[model samples]
Target: MLIQPVADLLSRNADHYLIPADIVANVQTDNNLYHAFLVLTKIKYSKIPVLDHAGHFEGLISLPLITEQMLGFDQLNVEVLMEKRVSDVMETQVKTVPNVDDVESTLHLMIDNPFVPVVDNDGLFQGIVTRREYMKSFNFLTHEIGKQYDMIEKDFSTSEKSK
Candidate 1:
């Protein structure tokens, strides 16, 4: 099949690529680092979404960043460090794509961000599309494409043998 058909299928399904907020844990700005760390460790998520008390998307936080903060202080200061708010450590330079944006574009953004936060036209927090989930979808497509290629090869061999 032509590449256009594949592109069309992927672009057309863009609306459904987002992983709804209900399924993921979003951290609050006022949440303590200790709590945030616990959540990240428990979920094993690649990235965590940071939101305000009103549910607005702020930025994305990773375990490594938080770990770095913890390492900045000595063991005696660990307690004080954990008491710091997530907003203090989370990356404020987060890149967000509008919810209306196509999945193809979102996939590109996911190349750098493990979790791409989805926002509404007004920039309210909607959900995220995780790299892990995206990879799963891409992997499935790769398997299907391999199967198609094998079928075509088998067909070509049979036709040549008959000729």
Candidate 2:
């Protein structure tokens, strides 16, 4: 109920929120843009993680990033999509939360990203913590806390009236 307590409660381990790397759809750095685009389209996700053959977190590739390569001055350059590697177009500056992170930091990162990738100290891909999953946990905590406070308030009022 208090600010400190709420903040502490929200500081849950990032691992608890993880959508493990194994289940997450991703593309390797060597993958061509054409294949990456198809994967994104098939999953209906705007973007997805990029990894190395060793499973290290490389960056992220989006539909727009692939589409940009397809655009040309006069006509669509379909060849670029087939030629360029995902590493050539993937956004390497993506923000990633460490595996040791807490939900509090991940929550901040999720403000701009749909999901924040988690990586180990070795930069190995761990998983992602999605905003949707965080929201579900937040919703449950708020409602349960609200109900507890309401019961306390009701008890307080009853005692006041009797006095």
Candidate 3:
């Protein structure tokens, strides 16, 4: 009942790979810009995923976006940033994938996004399948293919020597 040829694609490894909550800087929709800045700086993430109080995936907030907006103002201070909401500067047009969906689609989506927000059926926040995880899967599969090819070559050579 095993399907070896396409087994790698059907593997549940990436689907089950869950990201811990502590890794993401979940900037809330109502979170003040100053607070967002503090968290982003501490984590050193170029961009961050935004979540609502109900734990729904909103979009993303980037340091570049904040800096671009802040540069327009004369008095650039923490208080000035505190006056704004992360929602005000966030890019709502983000790429996201459903947790139940196939992880391959997510992998392809990651080409444009370094981080794809994992969402539930109701569009709630789950975790993430980062580039690191994706790359690991790719490397493992590549190694597997090479291993299979070597085995087949060795079998062919053994049979030919008997002739």
Using lDDT as the yardstick, the better of models 1 and 3 is 3
Scored by CA lDDT, what does every candidate get?
0.74, 0.84, 0.75
Error of 1 at 158 (Å): 26
- Over 4 Å off, model 1: 1-3, 72-76, 136-163
From the highest TM-score down, the ranking of the candidates is 2, 3, 1
lDDT of 1 by residue, 49-107 (tens): 99887778888777887777767434534674467888888888877888734566677
Predicted model with the maximum TM-score: 2
> What tens-digit string does per-residue lDDT give for candidate 3 at 1-163?
3246435543646665558445667799999888888888889888888888888888898888777767745665556577899999899987777772456677678888886788888978888878777677667776676755444444588788899
lDDT of 1: 0.74
- Number of the predicted model whose lDDT against the real structure is largest: 2
Tens digit per residue, CA lDDT, model 2, 35-114: 99999999999999999999999999999989998989999999998889999999999888886346567777889889
List where candidate 2 sits over 4 angstroms from the true fold: 11-16, 147-163
Residue 135 shift from truth in candidate 3, angstroms:
0.5
Clashing residue pairs in candidate 2 (N, C-alpha, C atoms within 3 angstroms):
none
